[model samples]
Target: MKILIPLDGSAGSLHAVDYVASHRQLFGETPVILLLNVQWKVATGNVKLFINQDTINDYYREQGMLALQPARDVLDAAALPYQYHVSVGTPSDAIAQYACEQGVDQIVMCRQGQGGLQTFLLGSVVTKVLHLAECPVLLVK
Candidate 1:
């Protein structure tokens, strides 16, 4: 089975990674794990005009690696095999797109324990991903 975990460098997001790592036995032998971090498109047309394309790409790469670090550490410590990717786009859209492209069997993510007003105002990524993803969406608290 191929599992996709979308992380945003939040403790809540890491909970999803923890859930998958801790429950390895349930997924059969050698399940494929994909860790994905989506960096918001920071370089717009105006910013691109001022900054070199290579510099902008470097900036995104740095930020994306930072976001993936904790989850990577967890997986590494557990001695689990996985592949990670960094993409530039909206988090929910990028996650859904990647999952679709990879043909992931499941998408596991966490929902922050935010109040109704805050969640409604911000429109949580988990909610958007759950709606957009084709496969089953597992919520880890």
Candidate 2:
């Protein structure tokens, strides 16, 4: 099975990684794992005018790598082999799109434990991903 884990550098996100790592045997032998980090696309038309495309791309790459670091460390400590990717866009959209393109079997993600008003107002990436992704999604809280 191919599992995609979307991380945002939060403790909540790392919980998902821990869940997967701890439940290794359930995934079978050598399951394909993907660690994906999506950086928010902040270089809009006005911002792009002041910065070159390469510079913006580099910023995204740097931020993406930083966000993936914790999850990577967790997987490494577990001695599991996995592939990782970085992309620039809305988090849910990027994750869903990548899962579709890669033909992933499932998406494992952390659920933000926000309050009622806050969760409703801010929305949740996991919620959007669940609606958008073609494959099954597992939430680790």
Candidate 3:
């Protein structure tokens, strides 16, 4: 089975990773794991005009890589083979799109992410993902 995990470097996201690690055997032999970190879209208008697109993209990539590290460590320690992905867009949209493109059987993610205020304002990515995803979504709290 192919499992897609969307992580944001938050403790809640790490909990999902831990859940997968603790129950690895349930996933069967050599299950494919895809780790994804979606960088928030840069704000538009005058601020963007001053910043080069490459610079903005690099910043997002750097942040995404940072967010991916812990999950990578977990998988590496377990000796699990996996693929990692990063994108710049809305988290829910990117995650759902990747899942569809990869034909993943399931998506595993946290119920919440790093910023409570952002989550409150933008709403839960998990909720949007559940609605948009064609495959099954498993949310770990």
Candidate 3, 44-133: lDDT as tens digits: 777687998889988988999999999999999988888998898989899999999999998988887886789889998888999999
How many pairs collide in each candidate, listed in order?
A: 0, 0, 0
In model 1, what is the error at residue 33, expressed in angstroms?
0.5
lDDT of 1 at 75: 95
Which residue pairs come into collision in candidate 1?
none
Clashing pairs in 3: none
Query: Over 4 Å off in model 2, which ranges?
Result: 113-122
Q: Candidate 1, which ten residues in sequence have the lowest lDDT sum? A: 113-122
> Evaluated with lDDT, which candidate comes out highest?
3
CA lDDT of every candidate: 0.88, 0.88, 0.89
Q: What's the residue-level lDDT of 136 in candidate 3?
A: 92
- How much is the lDDT of residue 107 in candidate 2? 93
Task: Give lDDT tens digits, candidate 2, residues 23-140.
Answer: 9788888678999998878998799789999999999899889889998999999999999999989888999999999999989988873236846775877888989999999998
- The true-versus-predicted C-alpha distance at residue 29 of model 2, in Å, is 1.4
What are the per-residue Cα lDDT tens digits for candidate 1 across 9-127? 77778898899999988889867999998888888779878998899889888988998899999999999999999999988899999999999999988877333684687688888
